[model samples]
Target: MALLEVRDLVVSYGKIRAVKGISFDVEEGQIVCLIGTNGAGKTTTLRTLSGLIRPAKGSISFDGTALTSVPAHKIVSLGMAHSPEGRRIFPRMTVEENLRLGAYSRRDKETDDDLRKVFDLFPVLAERRSQPAGTFSGGEQQMLAMGRAMMSRPRLLLLDEPSMGLSPLMMKKIMSTVADLRAGGTTILLVEQNAQAALKLADVGYVLEVGKIVLSGTGPELLTSDEVRKAYLGED
Candidate 1:
């Protein structure tokens, strides 16, 4: 069975529908990416999976448990972590404090160990552990956001736009970190606007246009697809 599954998922905001009956699955130990332009409902989908948004129709199953009605806070306890778009770190909090907050759902005593692991993944975070999150650069903040999510020891990690506004070098660093996470056996569902970068790191790729999936393929297949090349990769 897939580690995470969404079937006929539908989400709406009042009279307007943002996601229209889309379906997909992420198997264990794989990086599944949903690539699209702005307003394609990529963020909405991640929010729905994280229980931040209620779906109007359909079901979400993670590890064989139905998550359709789970509360947002409770979802984290179930081993799903969402690193939302825009790197919404607590600006006034120290980097260590922010990472601690991500373990709110945990009752175990491994938080310190997890914190160390996060610092190892992004060594810069270790250097800035005592500093306020707002003082960090864009790439550093992004690292903190992802590290915070990692604090939960999640079985499934949902990442939304991890490379939004970083320099090309920073973008590469962020994507490399993602690959490392997957290599360490963390399942990931990534939403990204940078199709080339996302597809390069993905095991499977789905293309969403205005809330509907228009194409699905393996990473390399989508990278070479004519339609994907024209619409997302800027290849004429």
Candidate 2:
């Protein structure tokens, strides 16, 4: 079975149908990227999967268990973590404190080990563990956000716009870490506006337009496709 399954999903903001019957899946230990332009329901898809927004219709199943009706907190405990857009770290809290909060639902003996793993992934976070998250540069805050999500020891991770609001160098740094995360055994469902970076890292890429999947293929396939190259890859 797929590690994550979103089937015929529909979501709405009042009368505005945001996700109009979308479907997708992520396999274990694979990086799956959802790429689209703004207002294309990319964020909406992640939010619904993370339980921030309830779906109007369809099923969301993780590890073969239905999660559509589960609360966000409950979903976290079920081994899924969401790193939302805008790098929503606790501004006033110490970096360590924010990371600790991510493990609130975890009671396993390996909690400390997981924390160490996150530290290793972003050594800068360890260096600034005592500092307020708000004090870090945008790139640093983004690292902290991913580190915080790692605290949960999730089986599947949902990343929304992980490279947003960062310099080109910072975007490369963060994207490299995402590749490392997959090597370390975390399944990822990534929603990103940065189509190039996302497709490069993804095992499979799905293109979303107007709340529906318009195309999907392996990373290099989409990268080399004439249509995808013209529309998203910015080929002349």
Candidate 3:
């Protein structure tokens, strides 16, 4: 069975639908990416799966447990961590404090070990552990945000637009970190506007347009497809 299964999911903001009956699954130890342009409801879909936005219809099951009715905090405790769009780190908190918050749900001594692991993953964070999160540069803040998410020791990590507001160099660093995380057995559901970067790193890819999936394929298949090349890769 898939580690994370989303079946016929629908989400709405009042009368307007944001996700119109979409379904996807992420297997254990796979990186599944959803690529779409702005306003295509990619972030909305991630939010719904993360339990930040309640679904209007359909079911979300993670590791065979029903998640559609769970509270956002409960979902995280259940081993799904969401690193939201815009990198919403607590501005006044120290880098260490911000990361500690991610482990609030856990009582195990291993949480500290996970914190050390995150620092190892992003050494800049270790260097600035005592500093306020707000003081970091954009790229550094994004790294801290990801490191904070890692503190949860999640089985499924949901990432929304990790490369937003980053320099080209910063974007490369962040995406490479994602690849490294996947290699370490993290199952990820990624939403990205950078189609080229995302597809290159994903095990499988799905394209969303107007709140529905338009295509789904393996990474190279989507990368080489004529429609994807024209619409997302900017190739003629």
Candidate 4:
């Protein structure tokens, strides 16, 4: 069974429907990416999957359990973690404090070990554990966001716009770490605006336009697609 499955998910804000009947799946250990421009509901889909926003219609299944009615904290314990858009790190909180919050759903004793793992993945965070997250650079904050999510020991990692605003060099580094996380056995469901960077690493890719998935394919196939190139990849 797929590690994460979303079917016919529909979400709205009062009168406006943001996500329209989208269905997708992420097999264990694969990078499945959702790509679209602003206002395409990419962030909304991630928010809904993470249980921050309830879907108006549809079902979300994670590792065989239905997640529609599961509360957000419960969803975290179910081994799904979301690193949301804008790298929403707490400005006043110390880096360690922010990371500790990610493990709040756990009742186990391995949080210290997992904390070490996050440090290993982001050594700079380790070096600055006592510093305020807001004092860090954008790239550093992005790393902290991902590190914080990793604190949950998630089976499936949902990353939204991991590369939203960063230097080209930092973006490359963050994207590589995403691949490494998959290599280490965490399935990833990614929503990114950097279509070229995202599709390059994705095993499967879906194109969302105006809240609907307009096309789907293997990453390379979509990379070669003329329509995708024209619309998202900055080609003719």
Q: What is the C-alpha lDDT of each candidate?
A: 0.95, 0.90, 0.91, 0.94
Q: Which stretch of 10 consecutive residues in model 3 shows the poorest summed lDDT?
A: 104-113
Any idea what lDDT model 4 has?
0.94
Worst 10 residues of 1 by lDDT: 135-144
Q: For candidate 1, list the clashing residue pairs, or say none.
A: none
> What tens-digit string does per-residue lDDT give for candidate 2 at 5-116?
8899999999999999988889999999999888999989988888889999999999999988999999999999999898999999999999989899887777678778
**Lowest summed-lDDT stretch of 10 residues in model 2?**
106-115
Ranking by TM-score: 1, 4, 3, 2
Candidate 1 lDDT (Cα, whole model)?
0.95
Candidate 3 residues 138-172, lDDT tens each? 88888988988889998889888999989999899
Clashes of 3: 0
TM-score computed on alpha carbons, candidate 4: 0.98
Residue pairs that clash (backbone atoms under 3 angstroms), model 3: none
lDDT ranking from best to worst? 1, 4, 3, 2
RMSD vs true structure, all candidates:
0.7, 1.0, 0.9, 0.8
- Model 1 CA lDDT for position 137: 88
Give me candidate 1's TM-score against the actual structure: 0.99
- Deviation in Å, model 2, residue 20 alpha carbon: 0.3
Model 4 spans with C-alpha error above 4 angstroms = none
- How well is each residue in 49-163 modelled by candidate 1, as lDDT tens digits? 9999999999999999999999988999999999999999999999999999999999999899999999999999899899999999888899999999999999999999999
lDDT (C-alpha) at residue 3 in model 2: 94
